[model samples]
Target chain A: MEVALETNAVFVGIEYLAIFVWGLSGGLSAVRKRYDLFSILTCAWMTALGGGLVRDTLLGDLPPVGITDKGYILTCLASGLVVAVAHPEIMRLKWTMVAIDALGLGLFAVNGTAKALAFGSSGMTAVFLGMATALAGGLFRDLMVGEVPMIIRDKHLYAVPSLIGCILTVIVYKIVRAGTVGMQWEMALDVVIVAVVFVLRMVSVACNLTFPGAVDRGGGASS
Target chain B: MEVALETNAVFVGIEYLAIFVWGLSGGLSAVRKRYDLFSILTCAWMTALGGGLVRDTLLGDLPPVGITDKGYILTCLASGLVVAVAHPEIMRLKWTMVAIDALGLGLFAVNGTAKALAFGSSGMTAVFLGMATALAGGLFRDLMVGEVPMIIRDKHLYAVPSLIGCILTVIVYKIVRAGTVGMQWEMALDVVIVAVVFVLRMVSVACNLTFPGAVDRGGGASS
Candidate 1:
C-alpha cells in the first residue's frame, strides 16, 4: 500500500510535466496564428487537458481532474502565459520539445491504460483510450486553430509509440495481477514501459521512421 | 408520476431523432470528402454522438449512452450506411436538412441542460455543457474531414440558438421546481422551449443572421 501511494506521487509529478509541455505547444500554435490572449490561453488549456478529459470520461471518471483539480488547471494556464510572454522561437528548441512530448506521451499512455483497466474496461478499450489520452489534446488544439490534426495527417511514429506503450502496460498489468508480483515490481515495470515508449519515439524521430500512406487516395469509388 | 414517465418517453424519442439527423449530416460530410466506407461510418458516429459523450462525461454520467447503448450505436451506423448508399444530394434538400438539424439542436440543448442540472452542475457550467453537447459532434465531424469547424468559422445563428435554449431550459426548470407546478406543466414547457429554439434557429438562418467577425484580427502585438 505504501509503495502504491509513492508510485501515485511519481505518476502525478510526470503528469504535471506532461501537461505543461503540451500546454506550451498549444500556446505556441496560437502565437503563430497571432490570436488574442483569450484564444491563446484557451488553446493551451485544451491541448494540455483534452486527452485526459476524454480518457477519464470514457473510463467513467466524473468531473474530470482537468477542470476540478486546481493544480492541473493552474499548470496549464501558467504554461500558456509563459509562452505568450516568452514568444520563443520554438523551432530552436524543437529537439527539447520533442523529448518532453515523448515523455508526456508515454506517461499519458501508460497511466491512461492503467486507469482504464482499473475501471474494468476491456483491454482493447483500454488501449484505445490510452492512445486517445495521449493524442486527443493535440487533436483538439489543431481543430481550434483550423488545421488538420497532425496525428491524422502526419505519418509519423507518434501514435505508434503510444499504442505500443498501452499494449505493453496492459500486458504487464495482467501478468502482475496473475502472478505474485509485489507492488514495487509492478511500479518498476510501469516505469520501464514508459521509458521504452520514450526510447521508441526518439528512435523513430532520429531514424525518420513513418507509416506508409494510404494505398490509393481518391482512387476509390464515390461514396 | 405517470406524466413524468410519459415525458421521458417523449424525450427519448426526440433524442433518437436528433441522433439520426446528426449522423446523417456527418455521413454527408464524409461522403462529400470521398472518404472510404470506414471513414464515413466513423465520421457519422462521431457527429451523432460526440456532443452527448462530452456532455455526459462532464456531468459525471458513466459509460456514456453513446457507446454503451447498442441502439444508439446501431442508429449511427445505419444512418452512415444510408448516406453512403443513397449519396443523397444534401444541398438540394438543404431546407429540409436545416429544419431537421434545427430540431436536433433544440433537443440536444434542452436535454443537455436538464441533465446537467440534474447532475448538480452550476447554472453557468450547465449552459456551457448544453451548448457543447449540441455542437461538439459537428465540430468533431468537421475536424475529421480536415475542415475548420463550421461552429467556429460560420458565426451562424446555430450556436446562439443552442445557448438561448439552454438558458431558457435552466430558468424554466428552476421556476418549476420553486413553484408548485405539476410535472405535466413542466413537460409542456419543455416542449414549448424546444419549439422556441427551433423557430429561432430557422428564423436566423432565413435571415442570414450571424455573429460579427473578430473585432481585430492580427492587431495584437506579437506574442
Candidate 2:
C-alpha cells in the first residue's frame, strides 16, 4: 500500500504562512531593486508561487496549482502592495525578513519532498525536487532582477539546509514505510525536518556562513 | 479528432540546426562573460534546450525530449566545446550568429505552437506557448549570467517575429482542420510559418528595427 501525503489542517496553515512570507521577501527584493509597481507585483507573485509551479511542471502536473489558487494570488498581491507603500520601514526590519524567509524555505522544502513521495517518486528524485522547489522562487526573483542566483554561488548555506531537510525527509519516509509507522509519526517527522531546516538556514544567515572549496572561494568564509 | 504534430524529416533537420546554433550562441555568451569551461558547457546546454523543456512542461509532456534524447545533448555539448575553444573568430562573425539565431527562433516558434495545439491547448494558448518557447532559452541564459533579458527590453523584433509565426500557425491549423487539408499541406504551412518568422527576425536584426510603444517609445516608427 502506498502512503499519500495529505494537505491536512496543519499543512494548509503552514503553506499559507510560508506563501505570505515568501511574498513579503519577494516584495523586499522588488523594493531593493526599485522596480515599478507592475514589476513589483509580478516579482511578488512569482517569488511566492513560482517554486510550486516549477515543481509541479517538472512532475507533469498540468495547469499548475499555483496559477489556479486564488488565496495564494491574493496573498502575494497584498504583500506586494504593502511593501510598495511602506518599503522604507519594512526594509529596516531586515532580520525579520530573513527569519520569515528561513521559515518559508523550510516549509517549502518539507512540503515539496512529501508531495514528491506522494507522487510515487524515488527517494533521490524526491530530495532533488524538494531542494529545487525550495530554491526556485528565489532563483526566479534573482534572475528577473538581473542578478546571479545566490544558491549557485554556494553562499550562506541556502540550498544546503533545504538539501539536508530533504535528505532527512527521505530517511524518515523510508523508516515510516519499513516499520508501518502511523500517520502521526509521519507528521512528527515532517515537523522535525522543517525545524531542522529552519534552524540550519537561519544560523547560517545570521552568522554569514559560506560554502568553501565550492564557490566564492577567495572571499572570507564568513562576512 | 485530435490534430497531431509530426517532427518530420525537414523539421528534424531544422531542429538540430537550431539546437546547434542555440548552443553556439550560448557558448558565445559564456565566453563573453569569461566563464569556466564547465560553466560554458552548462550555458550551452541550457540555451539550446531550456525552451523546449519549458514548452513541454507547459504541455504536461513528461521527461522533456531535450533531456531524454542523447543526440540533442551531444549536439549542444559539441557546439559548446567548439565555440568555447575557438571563440575569437566565431565572435567576430556576429551577423552570422544573429542569422542562425533567427532561424532557430523561427523553427522553435512553429514547432512549439503546433505541439501546444496537438496537446489540446486553445489557439491563443498555443500562440503564447510558442513565443515563450522561442524566448525561454535566451531568457534562461541571460538570467544565469546576471543580465536583463533582451526579450523584456523589446529593443528588437525578437518576440514579435515569434508571435507572428505562432499566430500564423494557429491560422494554418484552423484552415487545415476546416478544409480537411492533407498532411502535406499542413506540413507546408508549418514551413511557411518558420520561413516567415525567420525572414522577419533576420530583417529586423539587419535593419536594427525596434518595436514601437512596446519598448522603444521614441523612434521613426518605420525603421
Candidate 3:
C-alpha cells in the first residue's frame, strides 16, 4: 500500500493506459452482449478495477484504492464511453485490443504482487493476490456475459503467465529484502516482471501455447 | 467482528443451516446446468461463502471467517456433493429448497449487518454490506450458471426483502447503541429481522408481489 505513493507519480501514465485498455475491452464485451449502457459502465469498471479491488480487500485494505481514487474511476469511465461511442471502429482493431489487454495484464500482475508484499503479506499470499489482481476482472466479465470463464475453461494460458510474473515479483522481493531495498530497485523489478508477463502472454497467444492437462481427451481415455 | 464471537454459540445453529441450504442450492444450480462436479463445488462455495468473503474483505478483515472456519468449507462441499449425486430427488422437493433458501437469506442479511456494525462501520455502509452479504453469493451463482442474475434482472424481489431486513438491522443497532447493548438484545434483533425477511420473501412468492417500477412497460404507452 505504501509503495503505491512512490509509484503513483512515475507510473501514473502506464496505469491510466492500462485502465483505458481494460475498460475499453469491458465496454466492448458488454456492448457485444447487448447489455445496456449502465451495464457497459459496470463491465468497464470491473475490467479496469475489479482485480485491484479484490487484491486490496484480501490484503485487509478497506475502501480499495480503485474506489477511492477519482482519477482511476474517471479514466475507466472515459474508456467505457469511448468504446460505447466507437465500438464499431474499435471492433475492427481486434488485434490492437488484444495487445493492449496483454500489456495491462502484465503491469497489473507485477504491481499487485508488489503491493501485497508492501502490505506485509506472505510470499504465497502475495502471489495469489497478484494473480487475482491480473485475472479476476476478466473472469468477472466472462461471467457477466454468461460465458464460462476463459481463465478456467479456455486453454489460453492467461493465468499461467500471470503466475510466473507474480512468482518473479516475490523472488525479487525475497532477494532484495523488499523493505531494505532502494525504491529504484523495486521499480526496476516491477519493469522486469511486467516485461516477462507481457512477453510470455504474447508469445503464448502467437504460438497457441497451452497446458496439455487442460485438454479434453474425449471418451477414449483409459481412466 | 467481535459480535460474532458473542453470537457464535447461540447463532451457530442457524448459521450452519443457512450454509447447508445455500450450498445445496448452489450445487443444484450447477447440476441443472450440467457443469462438472468441481464446478458444482465452486458454485456451492460461492453461494454459501462468497458473500461473507466479500463482506469481510470490504470490512478489512483478513482471512474471512468463512474460509478460516473448516466447518464452513466442509459443510458447503458436503452439500454440493449431496446434490451432485442426488439432484433428481433434491429437485423433487422444490418447495423445501425455497423455504430453506429464504431462511438462509434472512439469517445472512441480519447477521451481516450486525457484524458490520460490530466492526465499527457507519449505519449506511453496514446496511450496504449486509445486503451484499445476503445477495452477492446468489448473484455470483446465477452468473456462474449463465443466467441473468435474479436480483438484477428477474422480478422475484430477491434483493428487495433482503435490503429491508438489512436496513431494519442497522436501525436496530441505532436504537440499541450496538456496542453498549448486551448479547440478548443483539440476538433478539437478529431473530426479528430474520423473521421479517422470511415472511416477506415467502409472502412475495406466494402472493406474487414485486416492485411495480421494475416491470417493463414494453412498447405500449399504457394499460
Cα lDDT tens digits, model 2, A22-74, are 88778778888788998888998889999988878787766777899898899
Q: Rate the local accuracy (lDDT) of all candidates.
A: 0.80, 0.79, 0.79
Candidate 2 chain A minimal-lDDT segment of 10 residues: A213-222
Residues B1-223, candidate 2, lDDT per residue (tens digit)?
2333344776688788889989988877766765555556667888998898888777767746655567788899898888766676666677888888888898889888988888899999999889878999998888777877878875879999999999999988988878878766988778878889889988887788878764565777658
Candidate 1 docking classification: incorrect
Ten-residue region with minimum lDDT total, candidate 1 chain A: A1-10
TM-score winner, 2 or 3: 3
Model 3 chain B: lowest-lDDT 10 consecutive positions: B1-10
The DockQ figures for the candidates are: 0.13, 0.12, 0.11
lDDT of 1 by residue, A87-158 (tens): 554536789899999999999898888878888888899899889899999998998889888999866699
Q: Rank the candidate models, highest DockQ first.
A: 1, 2, 3
Per-residue error (Å), model 1, residue B20? 16
- The segments of candidate 3 whose C-alpha lies over 4 angstroms from its true place after superposition are A1-50, A57-118, A122-128, A140-149, A152-223, B1-6, B34-42, B53-89, B121-125, B144-146, B153-157, B171-183, B206-223
Worst 10-residue stretch by lDDT in candidate 3 chain A? A214-223
